[model samples]
Target: MINTHTNAQDLSSWQQKYPGVSEITTDYSEHYQISINKNNQLVITQDNYEESMIITDKGTGFSAVESIVFSDLFRIKSYEAYTLNNVNGRQKKTEVAHIADKKLDRQSVFDSDVKLKTFNFANLTTGSKKVLKYEMEFIDPFLLHRFMFATSAVNEKRTLKISYPETVKIDYKLFNIDKNNLEIQTETKKGITTITFQKQNPVVVKQDSEAAGIMYEAPHLHFWISEYQTKNQTHPVLGSIDKLYAYYHTFISKINQTENQELKNFTLDLIKDCKTNEEKVKTIFKWVQKNIKYVAFESGYEGFIPREAALVYERKFGDCKDMASIITEMAKYANVPNVNFTWIGTRELPYTYQQLPAPAIDNHMIATYINNNELIYLDATNATVPFGLPSSFIQGKEALIAQGNSYIISLVPEVKSNLNTIHDKIELSLIDKKIVGKGTFDANGLAAAQYRSIIGDNLLKRKDFAFALLEKGNNKFKLIDFKEIDFDNSEKPYSIDYNFELDNYLVNSGNETYLNLTLDKPYQNDSFEPTRSQTFDHEFLQKKSYQVVLEIPSGHSVTYLPESTTFSNDLLAYQFSYSQENSKVYLNYDVEVKQTLIKPKQFALWNESLKKLKENYLETIIIKQHEKN
Candidate 1:
């Protein structure tokens, strides 16, 4: 049996049981010549820089020590020091040297019962190569949370020196490094630093150190590191996979022994009420959604599968995994067709289930499928989301569908992008040097789902929110009324009307106040900045309609009016019109996007249209205040 314990004595005993294991011995010392400059990039090097060294050793079968030695050239965001004691929740600690001498209280960040503790700085010499050393008495038994040793001294170069006893194998994974500016020279057979510069700024640094034991009998151990510049060079600590698994097993065992039986029975019985499979499926979905709330619990093992289906059902609340498990069970009992449990990430990801070996491909979710074909991704935490459309986040992702023991099916979906759509009408009056107008705005299709997901079930509040959004501009404004807001679970489109008053939305110092007729809708902007520097490629099914009737103040003449503009691209379609007669100006605008994906080649064109529309909105209305007297 595998023994998973973090206690020194427990680990010591376990190590003695395994013979022929490679003794763990590591000596890692690195130097840095660091200084801050204008670009805010850390410049570090070994020969002329500050230095640090750490020596860690562990006999065969025992977790090995991790140590560090350093000089003060490292300008860290924050410093936290720890000295081990036999207190209630205290873990290990290092001998204090450069910073203040103190022991740190240890508990996971998400541990509500634990007091929050912080360290401001560390003890070390301020000059180059001023060595400070810290030794780990024993191999750390527990997994360290997200804490990685890192520093970002503006405009400095950096280097690392690591030495192992040639007993343990090592592997390093690097991400977000500028390959053009980096070079590596090492004695170890397979120790190398990798770099990726996808985006233009703030290079991301990542490294993974792993030790492989004998094949199936022994588990592989690894230490992961990631560094980036934060306000104070601070990073959150997350535990390792082995430690997490152990913590999860312990928690699940405890939770299983105690759960709500009535809630379980209620959920089980709820499935029975469905007259048909479809109804049963829908009903079960509704039950889970109404009962379970989405709460992320990534502290230690809390990130794993929940305690039990019965307990989660009784509580009516759980993380994504918990809710998914419960729904899976209910679906099984109700005979709502054949369904499998699966994993999925939100929409921002481009990974597929076929890439299951990529451990970090997904973080949350469980997909329910019918006869191993049609699929419905469910997220119980999003209580207000309608059936069919998973929250926009998980719209396109890979899902690990359970098939049988050691057999899981990988599922991926075609991208389901939200289309741009806006319908609006405005009534306007020219007053003094400004133009006052009231208008109504509406939405449909994926655009409606996006709004509903955010607004939830509070229809009145949702309407008020829309009105408030439309009230923004360079002028003082107010929304007096709204109408025709409705949601249809069965229909592909949902609609809403928002009414409001605008003041000085557009103006000039002259005799005329010009108003641009392009309507700004909620779906106009996509919030993703890709690293590859590629332009947006997804096409949007977009539509915009607006009608504005301007009541010009008596004796005021129109100076300049914008000619109607219209255009269409592989990814978009648009039209606009303006007319003047007597004391009223009539303006109508319509925009519709016909595609779902936009290629990089078309991004420049899309940007041009967007710029033109924004310019139209910025065009001011110039009204002569009293006709210049």
Candidate 2:
């Protein structure tokens, strides 16, 4: 039983006093108590608790939460000196602090008005057990660095025994406020709300591990328990309009004045440097990116605007907000055009800005404007990236532009999702029964970008990487010419075309070996315990065209060739074919991920398809021993 009518004043309060408070531990276990009751409800109970930070902002009447666990990624790797599955620990004092203030204004807590104190958690363990306890304590609210803090206790083996709900509902209202620049909405719902967000297949969820470390990232998250009364009761709305207005005036005024003088002086001086408006804009853009390094250190008020453009210029370092402010001020100084700051999110969290509210969308970055007609998105931190192009993360999201007393919402460019295509063409001459060939490879879409980001600025390494794609092969290889397409230009489809040569793919007699390319990186079979039972299934759409042309040595006859194969299940389909014409062997393969996401019930089918693809890539052809001419 839970108490539903307890008010703030009625809650337990002892000043949270601790005498020697050096160490504490907690053990929590969750069990599916009920699934699909007569009222079509789902219930699960988690017996978990420890020292955790709770945000209670009067400005927005809503509270944010973050719980620190002993086995989390940061403490495990940073302090314990652990790598992967390995675990280690060191002796240190734990600190605890608290802050009850306004709604969240920025992600970090550099200039925040929060209280601080220290506690201890020197006694912790690394071994596995069904029930384990870890101690956690509050820290200055402004000290939190990431967007959210989540527990890492889940793995691939966790049990999810609850039944599905027929429908899910959500209700959101003004939870807290921090003027126009910042606000927090209280969102609550009964029934299964997570199911409503499922994609067509639901399998896509399984592709990326929500666990601690993997590519294709998303932010930390916090969820609270629900306690309701038998009947609904109307709640009063909370507001702090006076405080919000006062804070906004001071913060905005400080940011503007700090950068104003510098902009006026710079604009006057740049007048003599650039004869054309276009050159001037380009020059300024280059200067901002080259000079600024995005290092966010938000303690308290520093989270608002930067210290000022002059201070940023002298320091040569600032966070995303600071970089945006510097560029915005410089534009004014140069008398180029109007530039505005905007917010955006990366593709990791797929939320439609038009459909979802503003707060759910973006966490970082700003944009520049031209004559109030054209808009350009700039992220000075990505120095190597070309202008007009943001990292794949910011593509296709909503951006909020500051307008007088209000804010306007705008849509960023839509990201093009396409099937992956990898083509490999190799030509080789057999000397002493050793196969040699020059190869050209091509790829596109997200797959291409993933590969290019890994290839970096090395040509030899790129060729070697391609050869490594031929994972299991007994051969010495040499790569010749590798030509890859432009990866940074967002306007162009992601493409990679490279050329390479390989040697020693055949035995002394005439036997030949072939290599298969299947799910690499994120999908590789690495072992990790799962915390949630509902594993997400995903489908990968791919096509490959490899044309291998080889000439028979002296007097030789064709003895064998690979048999063509095709496979299709309810979730996916794949086809592989090989042809021999004259003295050349042509191989063609195509795989289509018909569905986007999958549910737990379909994991077996998805797993089978992946297994078949891996086997097909390993198929080889052999030629019978021939007489020497």
Candidate 3:
């Protein structure tokens, strides 16, 4: 039993104290009790409490909606909600009249047993308090739950308690906890151990513009049952990395790898004309990448189990696990050696299997092929990614490759900035009252792949996409004509040639003409917020080069030229240079970002670099008319 009264008077007092808080959490508590039942099964009982008060006049008459998700592994034992109102120093209570529980189809690709419980409290006026209480019983102790202390509202106090029998061993990890405000206590009695954690005036949850994931900044607890003893028998759960791998192996081992006749024949047909084993493997990989559609289904056991390769072949659609299975089997059929089923986490997750030996550590699956002592990771989810390049989201993440009796952990290599390059070459000249130019844009590596994906097969939208990519200067710039060359050829660089005109780009004041030669400043406004606490994630290394040749008209001569500028640091570098040769004024700009992550501590340096970059963009090239000879 936990405190349910929100105390409307206390909420009013808090309103005066805090001033502008939209809502305040009055009470938030959780208790979990774990024990071994007579049937030798581990059982967990959960008690939860949540209460909040609306403080501001802007928050009055707002509807409150609460939702909870559960599956067959857990059952809700009890649920109740109530509202308290303070009017003229009197307290009035109203119980919730309606609640709805319905099964949710998170994805249409597969069947799921997950359900969502939702209810609404309407007509919540100022100084109103709402409370919700629920209890759940876990049918499977292996499926543990996570508790987060910070939320959208300001939390005044939060308490968590866990009690377990002495015979059962549990492991817990605390993340992002503020040691200055957290309190812990432990007590043992009657062969039972209990641990309590309490915190007051916890930091309110604020969205960090630089954070890659909210979980990286929020305080939370992750605990799991490791081992238990019941009826003179000891059972091991997730006690170590080996045990975790073994448990995951159970799911992978169950996937039938026998290549059916259709799959074998199809794979053989795809590789029959290939010259080498590498080419054969790539042929099969590309076949699957272009054919199979990815449909993820994460409900109960369906999340871990991979459908048979033959079944997936028939359906032509499956989740990441299913895709991995089909690709692995197909490669084996093609006589490709060292084909491995690998588990990896995307950029959204910050944990590794060694740190947290649980399913939460990894959320994606791919096939790794070892050829000539080199590893080639393949993911069929993105049809645009070329061979030998890992998906951008999994770069630098750990890969848990499944071996026959053991597993190997390897780090995925990060793609170099030089490999993904964007080069722009333009020649500009003043025509009439507008600046007109003919330019060519070239992209290679991941840049090319990304452009191809964005352009897709819609022939009508290619010009529009090219215009959007080449947009520069101001809104008055327009694309007059464009042509895409080698865009469809993946082996070659994606190139686009376009001629554009900018209206009123050259301002004529008396004898001087002004032009801002900086066509595009991509990172001019990329400064991070000063108060951000989490590291910002950069998707990939990038290198950009721009060269502009301004052909001086017969009657014009350069009078004032912006000085060259260069900025460099370990993380990033930029160079802008201007020169004149005979009748051509050449401008070259180059930028390179060497790292894929910008830490919070590096924000100051990054901001300073941005400031310099913005200043360079503002420099203008002034030309004077030849005094009308």
Candidate 4:
């Protein structure tokens, strides 16, 4: 039997309070029990999780959804869910049928053993509720799960409990958790210890545009077993950086155990003519970047281990770890000293080894070269990034470098805004009712690398890509011909010289014609929302300068010009200048984004700086017929 007795007023109040929210978790609980396995390795013997949520929106009321992704290291023991109806302010539960357990191969020229388990609470109505319970077994103790206090949606009540025997020791790190809201209790009894974390409500989750990653924003707990005690002796798990490194060493120790003469000869032949160590490293790095294509694939523990160097070399394709392996082996074969195999986490995971010395903290691997105490990170997965600079995603991240029995942590340097620049110069002329121009554009550093990566070697996409980036004026603007497109030499900027015409860019009224001299305006209407809570992210720092010299039409005089303004502030610096000499009028626009994260506190300044540019973009230049004396 089924019954429906809903409270309209309560549902309406909830709907008004949390608009656009489809579901709200009323309660979520997770419990874990750790114990020693037959092999003396610590394992999660019992892992249980449950979540109960109420439907807040009519659309989502029809169906509630949940999923679990598992790899070889973790397996799901059981899963059950039920849809509960609001009957007389009480709950009546009905079983949810057809739980889907299937393999989902993430294929993009790659294969893996990862699988997905999903179920939906179908036929749910507004004000209805749902409950789900599941159990998971951790095959590997080192790869434990991090418990997040809440999702993007509102969480009313949440609890997490972990139980372990007296022989096991555990350590934890808390991120973005407020001490005021969190209630922690620890107790030991009957030769066992249990810890619990309870919270009524966390922060109001706000999904800001371009917000930092969830790991950086969410309140979460990451825990690991530091060590375990046995009747005979003690076994270390991951107490220090050295222990983590030692565990990682097991995966790569027997990788290239046998000689790889083919890879060695190939590497030797590739760098035979290189005279300097820098040259050798650059040569090897470029070879891997150009040759080996990156493909992600993981199976069992192979996800953490790098395959043999020779195997990857022969295949001509590998993932990040494999690429790191080859880059390291090749550099060593060429007699490059102080080469280190490195582990790093991209900006998405904002944790250092000292903060959480666990395998889960790092998601990427690279090869680093040390010279005069300067760490040169080489990430061959980025085919366009040059040797001296790291890929933008890893900037400001700590690199865990392997140096024989010990590890060194180094910070990847951030590229200066000036280094990654865009300087374009154009000479414009007023043709028959149109604007015609010949321009030369230069993009340096990471900007150049980004262009190269996008344009690649495809001759067909080059022109269209260039047009998309350089398109300005009006819809009828046309790119006539590319005089030059050079991306070969890393020493120089990625430069392009072309001729173009803006068909309807200028407005004319009798003898007077109007033109917006800030032709290539960037960051127009780029403003942060008032409701934004997190820091804004920029893919890379930028420095852009656009210059144009318009030849005064014959027998015409400048009647109106926008005032020039120049100012520099902490968030950004901008300049709009106009100068006239002889028969040509010059206009220059410059802007530099000085920092990566535009903090909420700097929103006003950031928006104001861009507002000035937007205001100038509306200002126009007027050319009137010269008055006869």
User: 2 or 3: which has the higher lDDT?
Assistant: 3
Ten contiguous residues with the weakest lDDT in model 4: 54-63
| Model 2 spans with C-alpha error above 4 angstroms | 1-150, 153-287, 330-338, 346-362, 368-376, 410-414, 417-425, 440-554, 557-582, 588-609, 621-629
What is the clash count of model 1? 59
Query: What do the candidate models score in CA lDDT, each in turn?
Result: 0.45, 0.43, 0.82, 0.82
Q: TM-scores of the models, in the given order?
A: 0.57, 0.52, 0.93, 0.92
Residue 281 in candidate 2, Cα distance off native in Å: 6.1
Predicted model with the maximum TM-score:
3
TM-score of 1: 0.57
Per-residue error at 288 for model 1, in Å? 2.3
Clashes of each: 59, 41, 0, 1
Instruction: Give per-residue CA lDDT, model 2, range 1-629, as digits (tens).
Output: 11123233321221132122222112222221222335433333222222211112122221122232321111211111110111233223222223222433455433433332212322222211111222222221111222211133212121111112223122222121112422222322464322111011011123344321211222222121122222243211112222222323344445655445655676567555788665666666667766676676544445555557777777888877788777767776777665755556554444444433333344576655654465666667655444554444565556666543445666666323243555655555556645555555556554464565576558657657765664223445454455545655432444434444344555443343333222122232522233333434232234444555666554555566667898987666677777777765566666655543344456666777777766776666554445555
lDDT of 2 at 355: 32
Query: How well is each residue in 352-448 modelled by candidate 4, as lDDT tens digits?
Result: 8888989988988898999877789999889988779899889888999888778788998889999999999999998787889999999998999
Candidate 3, residues 242-312, lDDT tens digits: the string is 87788878888867645499989988888999999889878888888778988877677887778899998
Off by over 4 Å in 1: 1-118, 122-182, 185-276, 347-356, 406-422, 427-439, 444-464, 483-499, 505-513, 519-563, 568-574, 577-609, 615-629
Scored against the true structure, residue 157 in model 2 reaches a CA lDDT of 20
